[model samples]
Target: MALLITDECINCDVCEPACPNEAISEGDDIYVIDPDLCTECVGHFDEPQCVVICPVDCIPHDPNHVETESDLMSKYKRITGK
Candidate 1:
């Protein structure tokens, strides 16, 4: 599943560059993850980079964008063409 940044985010600017898929961005109030591009770092790393580097623990799996490991891998391949 893609990760979501909650309202607890502090706009710390750490997660954006950590994302291998460039799914994280500055939102109006907090960082937002683009589900269409987010792969939870499936093909890029063992864990979600944004989640790993998030200081406030605001990142969480998105229930609305639920996906399996296979699904995340597929999305990663599609985005990276690898």
Candidate 2:
């Protein structure tokens, strides 16, 4: 599943750079994660980098974007041009 940044985000500005997929960005009121670009860091690391670094722990699985690990890997591959 893709990760989502809830309204709890404080716009700490840390998640954007930590996303290998560049999925995180500053929204009108908070940070937001693009589901299409999110892979939960499956192909890049053991865990989601944003989740590891998020101070507010606002990042969570996007129920609307639920997908299998294979789907995540496919996304990662597409993102990296692999």
Candidate 3:
């Protein structure tokens, strides 16, 4: 599953660069995670970088956007051109 940023984010910009998939971005207020591009670091890292860097703990699993490991790998391949 992909992780999402909640409205509780403080826009501190700490989690943006930490994302291995570059999924996190500045929103109207809190940062937003692009579900289509998010891979939960399946093929890139051992864990979600955004979650590790987020100070407010706003990033959480997106239940509505559940995806399998294969799907996440395919998305990662598409994003990185790997």
Candidate 4:
């Protein structure tokens, strides 16, 4: 599943660079995760890099965009064209 950044985010600007898929970006008020591009780092890392580096621990699974591990891998492949 894609991750969601809640209002608790402090905008530390760490998560944006940590996202391997480049899915995180600055929104009007906080960082937002693009579900279409988010792969939870399945193809690049053992865990989500953004989640690991976020200081506020505000990143959480996006309930509206729930997806299985296989789905994420497919997304990763599509993104990398591999």
lDDT ranking of the models: 4, 2, 1, 3
The lDDT values for all models are 0.94, 0.94, 0.88, 0.95
> What does candidate 4's lDDT look like per residue over 1-82, in tens digits?
9999999999999999998889999999999999999999999999999999999899999999999999999999999998
Candidate 2 lDDT, 24-70, residue by residue in tens: 88888998899999999999999999999999999989999999999
TM-score (all chains, Cα) for each model = 0.98, 0.97, 0.91, 0.98
Candidate 1 deviant stretches above 4 angstroms = none
lDDT of 3 by residue, 1-82 (tens): 8889988888898888988878888888778999988999989887888888777888899998999999999999999999
Q: What is the lDDT of residue 32 in candidate 4?
A: 97
Across 37-61, the per-residue lDDT of candidate 1 in tens digits comes to 9999999999999989999999999
TM-score of 4: 0.98
* Candidate that beats the other on TM-score, 3 or 4, i.e. the better one: 4
Error of 4 at 17 (Å): 0.6
Worst 10 residues of 1 by lDDT: 22-31
For model 4, the stretches where C-alpha displacement exceeds 4 angstroms are none
